[model samples]
Target: MITEARQPPGGGIGIAVRDLKVAYGGTRVLHGVSLDFAPGSFTALLGSSGCGKTTLLRALSGFVPVESGSILLGGEDIARLPPEKRGMAMVFQSYALWPHMSVHQNIGYGLKLRGASRAEIDAKVTSVLSILGLAGYESRKVTALSGGQRQRVALGRALAVDPPVLLLDEPLSNLDAKIRLAMRHELKSLHRRLGLTAIHVTHDQEEAMTMADEIVILDAGRVLQKGSPEEVYRAPNSPFVAAFLGADNVIAGEARLDGEALAIRLPNGGETRMPAARRVEGDCIIHFRANAVHFGAGSTRAGLRLAGRITQSSYPGGVYRYEVETPAGRFLVDDERRANPGEAIELLIPTEEMHVFPAGMPSA
Candidate 1:
């Protein structure tokens, strides 16, 4: 069984979802999911499409009704609160901007609806435009702006309300790759500058890993893992998390607890000890990134090494991706130098960097 993390920080208007569950009438979606978002911290809800990440986000905003659970906002159960009453704002993938409203009007619309005076709305909108770097263009219609500018306007609108929490649903998806990367840094900076607690939902692994202080990886409506970006990436608890986090190379087989050491039996009738302190059992898989596995022209490690014949090679951009057939199995090897097809080579994975997971174990 997977154990919960213990290093939770306290005191924040940030959300804590305990035993949270949601479903569509008869079919269950989220399963007893729990997560914490600290005030002024950025958290990403990451998973493949249709994985209930959006549902979970909506639940946090009180848009989706929770069947059971407590959405503790500053330790108060606000699960039953209406979406508008929660004092949180969200930005959608489409920007969700009103085409008919000018940038300024759209930004100040929220405050206006809340009965702010005309002068107050104008003042808030002016400050927001300046803060979001959209100054001198507040009068422009939404349709006249470029994608990045429109994104900024959307952000300005969200921030104009000064909500304690900000929910971003794939806010960078529509931008080009370069623009997206730039915006990611901007968002991080904005978070730090404003000290706003933000929950971002994204399917892009790099985006989530880059922007979030912590990540909650979800799959099939359940959280597979949650940890600091490095913790989840370096020490994933399952094969699924490893694979999901881009641990593509695999040497899966059987293993047993031989006293304190795990004796992993190789496919070619060889066995290796993974030292003591291994927890998982039964069939297990060890995954290393393709970049982690390399083609060594000369073998340095003597025993317990893989000797494979490189059968395919492709120059994908600056790096070489190679397919190696070994005595144990086939593995993808990524190298900087080109290896001629059908060349025999040795691939080494530093034991310390190898991520291992027990078979048949479900992700969180």
Candidate 2:
């Protein structure tokens, strides 16, 4: 819990991070990172470990000092403000709850430190507990609660302060798979109901895609792209962004303008033609998700098709995934029907489903 800054009714103010840079031991971690978080919108900072996502979150929370940057909140610069004065609350990866304290006491700890009256603290804590569905657990020790209940206590504590902005550092990563999925819905609902601006940091792609209104994909301290989950996933600006967004199947080839279509000629002498937003030529890479690749030939053939033999197959519930070896290379394909290993199969990828990027260009 941080400052008690009131937001406008229905939503909090937006955050504008400009040219933010940070370093530890004279080695730069974040090199000129910038982003805008819409008011009341959920934005996820997504990237692999050591990509400076955590550093950026900590910098926004006033815990990590920036080398050169400005964090604008409500038209005011908070880059140099103390953590307790930033008008924001952060829920950490660990619940960070006091084991010895009761749920109510833990939720009221920040208020107590601020010299809030007992009556005010109790009221705020009680209200937050009810909102988090832990109304009756207030009197129980935090250690006695389940993992999900303890997480709610952490969230309740952060909400008790009524900060305009909430920062979550993989808050649900500590939960089991099932519990984590449940908490995702809970957090999304809570954010909407409270109308607070939220910035969530996570390495999980599904977490970001499911929870965020907008996703910022970062790598090596630089932002690769920032857009709605659909936009980034469907139309990545580069090979790196495409690959990072779960388009793991890639094929490198020569691309050229063939009439009104962008034609890609694979090394196997096959060509795939797709609609192009702009004219592009020369070497390029085609990226698509494993699920985008279909099995077998049909009346409606795909633009990119390859003949291959299944090297491995596994039934993962709804769909059977097959590792097919083709002229290009091995690729994983998801299909409804089961195909045995060593069986011949034709893999199909629709043109629109493939992400095409010029070779060696990592950005748009």
Candidate 3:
């Protein structure tokens, strides 16, 4: 479990969701989920389909009615408030821009609907256009803009309202790969400049890792883990989160306390000791990233060296991925050097790179 971080200077009040539960008719989508969004901090809600990430975001935005629990904004319960009444703005995945409206009109739509003076609406739109690098695009129809520009427009519209909290529901999923990567930095910069609380929902693990200050992993309507990206990646509490975060290499064995160290006994009569201090005993499973497995030419301390034969190989841009058969099991490895099938190879993995959990233990 991860604790809430400190608020940045000039940031808004923090948000707390206590035992939040939501449902759609007969079926519950969120089950007693709780979290705290630190003021001016960015949090990513990550999970697979039907994992209740979107449902949780919707509940936070007041778009979905809560079956139970309390949503406290600045220590005041806002669970019963309407979406518009809450001090929050949402940017949808579809860009949600009106094709017929010009960039300025679309950005200022909320202000107009709220009966702001024309001068005030125009002033806010102009400022947001410049902030989003759309100074000269105000008169252009949103349909004529590129995907990235449309994304900026949607973000600008959300910012024009000047809400305390920003809710993003897969806002970059529709953009091209290059644009999506670029927008990640842009969003981070915007969040810093505005000092607003942000909750982003994304199924893409890399996206969540790249943009979030904290990550919350959910599965089957329950939160499996919550922590900083590196913390969650390096010390995942369960097998599901380990695999979900790209640590796909799993090896099972029995572990026992060996004085100050944890030693694992493999089924094939091989043994290795981990540098961990925990005195865990019994059946255990080790999880590690594919790239964490180093082959030959690397110096890693307290590492396991395995002899294997390459069964398959493929060049995947920056790295060459290989499928190797070893005494432990078959697993994928990413290396900079190329090795052909049927070739003998050696691999090493540092003990600190492996995450160990008790087998058959359900996620917390």
- Least accurate 10 contiguous residues by lDDT in model 1: 1-10
List the candidates' TM-scores in order.
0.90, 0.93, 0.91
Candidate 2 regions exceeding 4 Å error are 1-10, 258-260, 362-364
User: How many residue pairs clash per model?
Assistant: 1, 0, 0
Per-residue lDDT tens digits for candidate 3, residues 315-348, read 8799999998998888788888888999998876
Candidate 3 pairs with clashing backbones: none
Ranked by lDDT, the better of candidates 2 and 3 is 2
Backbone collision tally, model 2: 0
How does candidate 1 fare on TM-score? 0.90
Strongest candidate by lDDT: 2
lDDT of 1 by residue, 278-318 (tens): 57577877776766777655645422467789999988887
Question: Over the full model, what C-alpha lDDT does candidate 3 score relative to the true structure?
Answer: 0.86
In candidate 1, position 309 carries an lDDT of 94
